[model samples]
Target chain A: MVRVDGKGSGALVEIRSLDKKYRRGGEEIDVLRGLNLDVDAGEFIAFMGPSGSGKTTLLNLIGGLDTPTSGAVRIGGDEISRLSGRKLAAWRSRHIGFIFQMYNLIPVLTAFQNVQLPLLLTNLSKAERRKHVEAALDLVGLSDRMRHYPRQLSGGQEQRVAIARAIVADPTILLCDEPTGDLDRAAGDEILDIISRLSKEYKKTIFLVTHDPIAAKRAGTLLHLDKGTLLECTADGLFACKPEDAGK
Target chain B: MAIPLEYNVRSVFIRWPSTLVAVLGIAGTVAVFVVMLAMAQGFQAMLIGGGSRDNAIVLRGGADSEMMSAITLDQVRVIADAPGVARSASGDPLVSAEVVVVGAFPLLATGSDANVQIRGLSPIVLEVRPNARIVEGRFFQPGLTELVVGRNVSGTYAGFKLGSTVEFGGGRWTVVGVFDAGGSSYDSEVWCDAVVLNQVFKRPENIFQSATARLASPESFQAFKDAATSDPRLTVDVFRETAFYAEQSRMVSTIIRVLGFIVAIVMGVGAVFAALNTMYSAVASRSAEIATLKALGFSPASVVASFVAESTVIALAGGAVGVLASLPFNGFTTGTMNWSSFSYLAFAFRVTPEIVASGLVFSLLMGIVGGLPPALRAARLPIIVALREL
Candidate 1:
């Protein structure tokens, strides 16, 4: 786990005592109960936990992808949880860029058109959207593969193209849920390297959820969640709770 | 709003099979519509073309068609002497007392013959109908067992040519010539002399089928009909030639219109089903991708819009195909026998531009209606749950 330098600072994403649940017939399944978190601007924070530990759920709440049942999520200065459907959707589009496990590129479209999908929501010109897509593909080192379909590319290339799509809208905060979960070790390393560079070089805040220690180690801060709670002890630096020897 | 060309084009190409099915279904509907219009037109032609503006069919009172009316030979002679009735230059009244009856001749396909109207006409009937001419060997001799078969009969009934013989009620009528009625009701008949036909049928003194008269003036019709009906000795009615023809075609017209609507509705149902199937399959196949779009900064509304747009593109392609497929049917001619006239009729398919436009609009509506439900499903997906599945 990586360590953070500052102890107190303004957070780009702030979660306040969140509780979430799922209803299966008459019974309720509690996914996250009373989870709290804060992420600062330009920070690269990795969340690590075993399966069913609410790592991704917490990330989703921070990104405004899902609403918390009993608490609030504030991004920048706006309390997102309190926003209505339309307002919440507008906020999400302007603030967050999400990366999922498998690259969800439209199979029939070229990689360039896939990257241009999000920009369609904006009032950008045709030429302008093209320019932004080209620049985004260049950022992911896939400028030449713009016209290729998703099936024509390797797993790494596809993931890179997906990354290009995510960045095309120029979102302030990036949310990645198991971004490397479907890639090989080498491809996973390359993806981690690109994500790390986004936070440090581009000065964008990133909140990533992963089970891989190597991917988690690249973050400037580490958040360890278990049973819907942030552990009290920091591993070595920031929010790391790899209480390995201590728990043993 | 400008949509990306690739977005619309690729979406249609991806769903080609479902698209083709939808187009063909709609095309079948349009074809049905065209054929029905042709049939109605054919029936109308046979009825209207058969009537001569200068001539009229005087039936007995309280009756419509000839089969339901009864006129005595005395009344027929007295009506023929009326001042309104025209006369040939030979000074003879240009009128003929005709007998019309429905009889059956065995058909090749059905094994049992359908009821066909047989008319016994005179040379004066020919003079009244200028358009009715003998295109074959000759007109039947005035008084004999020989008869003239109409153009329609020659085409539909085998052995209905000159020198051929047909049996009716144990009496063999030899066909002497095949004549064309120039697309009139006469085309449905077998023409024999009225006196001989009445004698053969043993109804020499009475005839239910009325007299055909060449009128002096069209305006004299009301006076002529009033005089004849009030004669007490003659209870008969009169109608304008066009009005009579229009009424005759009414039943077949109604039938064709109803069939056309049924076909259109059925086609609509089929196209809607195709649209639903395509959309449902599209949602299932693109669930993961759509979820990813929803998760990534893209709002649920945008994701739904994207999918709806894709489906609409497919529908538009299908609609275009259907419209093109229906184009060739315009002006295509087909033949059928009119139910009221018992005459064979040929008419062209009246595929108007407006019907084609409606077909396309209907297809688009099907797309919108079918796409809405699937779009809602795409919008309702939870990002975290979707990512977990992936």
Candidate 2:
């Protein structure tokens, strides 16, 4: 197994000395402290950690949703941390897709419209958008349920629709934060299967944050984040309770 | 990229109770604005319509209205002989020296004493005011105590109907005729023989209040005004009748407009707060949705525009309903005191296209003012914090 300590060759995402801090009434809390990692394209990396371990914070920085307090984050050679507001948004639309645990689909829009959201940023014709949306929905095996709204769809189905939305724009990277945290075990596995397929078949660079080890087992590489520090870990080491047996 | 309009529309209905309160609030504000301004428009229209561009009115130089002006028969003669005074085919000047006075009359509906204008003019009154016609009976005969009531006066005041005897100016006069003044402010007056009215009212027979003269041409007004004012023997001012009436309407119309705006603004503030509450509630309730949209790379401007558009649409709907509500009041006859004449003038509510358009624009302004703060708040919401709400 390869480590992700900023030494990967031809890495698609590079994080160097990244730090994030929050101020809480005269107290400065360090969420991420001098975190460094490198991830190559098409890698399905699952990040398992406790609450406040900065796993989601790292994903947010990589996705350009937040800026690190210190150091640089470069994705595909573009130093996204330096991008201005509108530029960062444009970069995000073009490159990053997000999937959340709650299946954050707009309640008002149908499944098809939800998937077509990112495509609206492009200058594609309406028919072209329709074609892409249908293909993405079909990939999630929800082609027949395109017209159903979020409330009409079941929990697992809503997550699948969210997955369709994430992939419809064919983004370069998928930043999924606890995408299956609210789901049953079967639904969780189903979401992990789609995410694994997205990485393998579409060659999408995936960064998944999850606490479920069974979900993390589907990843090509598994890492543990403990107190804002990242370390390589195996599936066997994942289930161990002892502090020394946790990660290498 | 812009957010889809369908999203905002569905959200509005999905949360309909608050939307309804906002809509009704805006609707009430617009309705009040429309009705109040329509009243001003109607009063101004009636008074302004009473005068013709080709007629000139001679009044005392310092007087603001006929009620305040006093012109003797001798001065009227000089005014009639002034340059640019039109003449009939018989070579007589088309002038009518009139005495204007206010009489207290019992209102038919409320039985309260209200002021009614009484005009005493020469028999040539109909010729000078071509719009006035005997709609029900013949005009009053000269040198007689017969009275001819205007259509509005006969209908609004007690004992002013045709053939009814009414006491005024220390005499019992018979209502022998009813005239229509072509929907002008003159509809609120009564006319009788100048000599008879002066005799009963105890004024000097030679004294009159104003003289209305038809001009040879509308362009002859300046010459007539110069001629009347320059005459040393006559202490009088002359104005194109249309201009005089337009000026007379200014005080009442301005008061109505100012009062209307003050009331509308007062109500508009409440409407704005209602809109703010609705939008803030919307933003708070949709925090997760907003975060999802932001994460999808919808710009802050797009989010702001979407929320503002929703508010504007709601306000526009309210405006449409308000306009519809005001339409029924159009041409519905009502009366209010004319400050210049100091008498009740009957006129209809005039909801012109311009007034309706102004109301809609006013509501649109309210929507923008009310929605902007909440929209900006929604736009500036941090994506991570809102996502955590999910």
Candidate 3:
């Protein structure tokens, strides 16, 4: 019932009192509790937290991969949390791009084919789809390695392919869950540089979940989560109590 | 929207060992199914192929087969004289009064004794049965202890070649010729003169087992049937030769088909379980991949379709292998006891195109049935749970 007007209003993601709960046997464990946040267009935000602090859960809720227990997630003026299962999947395909810690490239598909997967859901012609896939792989600097399978690519190259797949559809928001978690320091830095360039040059809104402090430092805004709550950390310390509290 | 079919195909090849288990299991089932149906088909073809639409058989009333029918010489004459009977070049009716009896003979391949039909034929038998022709040597001379063996009989039994002597019924009968009946049931028989067989088997002087006559035309069958059944003095059953042989094949073919189907179904049960186990493991091992696809916004329907497509591909592969494995059995000769004639009948295995198609369709159905539960399980898995698996 409460909708946030995000499209043409310069806001890309808007969350309000979002809560996620999981029941293990009999006890209800709160994963995300009463979370409120607003991300503007073309901004990059990093989510940092200890284990079990609901960082990935909040990203999943925003991407429509998982629904919030009792809150609304609005992106580009669409209330995704209220959408049904099939509609939510379609919405996610059109609006969100996902990058996982493990690269998550389909092992059987070559880099080009994996990047072309999300586009298969569209009604694009084969040639048109190929054109888009090649452009995305070119952007990721893997144009020459398009035919190489995931097992044949290096860790950093595989991650680059994953990033190409994540952005091939040109989704409005890019959700990266520990994108640099599995890479070495040099490979991880290369990935961060690409993410930073995507946000600044391509005008893409990005939300990244990570444990690496260096990866978090590249984001324009950094937020820390503890015990299902969100806190903003500035250069001095974690000073902002909450986005709602700071607004009050 | 559906996923590209190539994705499922490549996945099947990527997991070759597990796919091989499902394929070979289904292959075993389809092979058993096809080979058994082929046996039944061969048996049916042997009997049905022996008959012609323009010929009619005469047997005693209430008799189920020629072996059970007894025709007196007077009755044979009356039937042969019927208005619709066709005549040969000599103007005599194209009729044969034949005696049928079973004789035990040793198989050349196994040396085990089996019952073979000994037929006593009148002179006009080749005229009545146009398909029966001597392929080697000559027909037996009348009034002598001479016999001609069918090609299948000579091939299957010991000591039945031309110039060889077979001891039976207290005498040695010399084989004078070999006959072929174009793959008909008569190819399993040994032929001799009616008078000689009567004397050898100690049958009555004026009695024979059955009589067959060629009709003037196939349309004359109704007139022939009416003439024979209306005679109060003669108690006889008349049938078109085709209908008679088809009746003879009913019980044996049914038994064979039922046996074949039972074996296939038993093996099919094992195949279904093997497929189930293979698919469940595939789902388990690929949970993370499935989760990734789900995260990429693929619907559960697409996931289910992909897995089902993979399963069907495996089953069709097995079906193809099964068809190839059963190919060697086609036209391979073997023998079984004909319950109607109370004798061993040799036939070849027939693997018709229809049988092959049915076997493949059967395997495809098995794949669909076997893949359903696992596909549903894959679809119903919570995305969060699957993502956490890895």
TM-score of each: 0.73, 0.92, 0.90
Residue-by-residue lDDT tens digits, candidate 1, B277-377: 77777777667766666665566666677667766666666666766766676666555556654644444455565666666666677667667777778
Cα lDDT of model 2 by residue, B1-390, tens digit? 589989998999999999999989998999999999999999999998899999999889899899888998889889889899988888989999999889999999899989999999989888888998998988999988999988899889888989999998899999999999888999899999988999999999998989999989999999998988998999888888999999999999999999999999999999999999999999999999998998998988999999999888878877888788888888988998988888998898899999999999999998898889999999999999999997
DockQ, each predicted model:
0.32, 0.68, 0.57
lDDT string, candidate 2, A138-243, tens digits: 9998999999999998899999999999998899999999999999989888888999899889989898898877777777777778888776444475433222
lDDT (tens digit, per residue) of candidate 3 on B101-185: 8899999989999999999988788989999999899999988889888889888998898999989998789999999999989
Tell me the spans in candidate 3 whose CA falls farther than 4 Å from its real position.
Answer: A1-12, A232-248, B73-78, B81-86, B142-144, B170-172, B216-235
Judging by lDDT against the true structure, name the best candidate: 2
Ranking by DockQ: 2, 3, 1
Number of clashing residue pairs, candidate 2: 0
Evaluate model 2: give its TM-score.
0.92
The TM-score ranking, best first, is 2, 3, 1
Q: Is candidate 1 or candidate 3 better by DockQ?
A: 3
A-chain TM-score, model 2: 0.92
**Candidate 2 overall Cα lDDT vs. reference?**
0.89
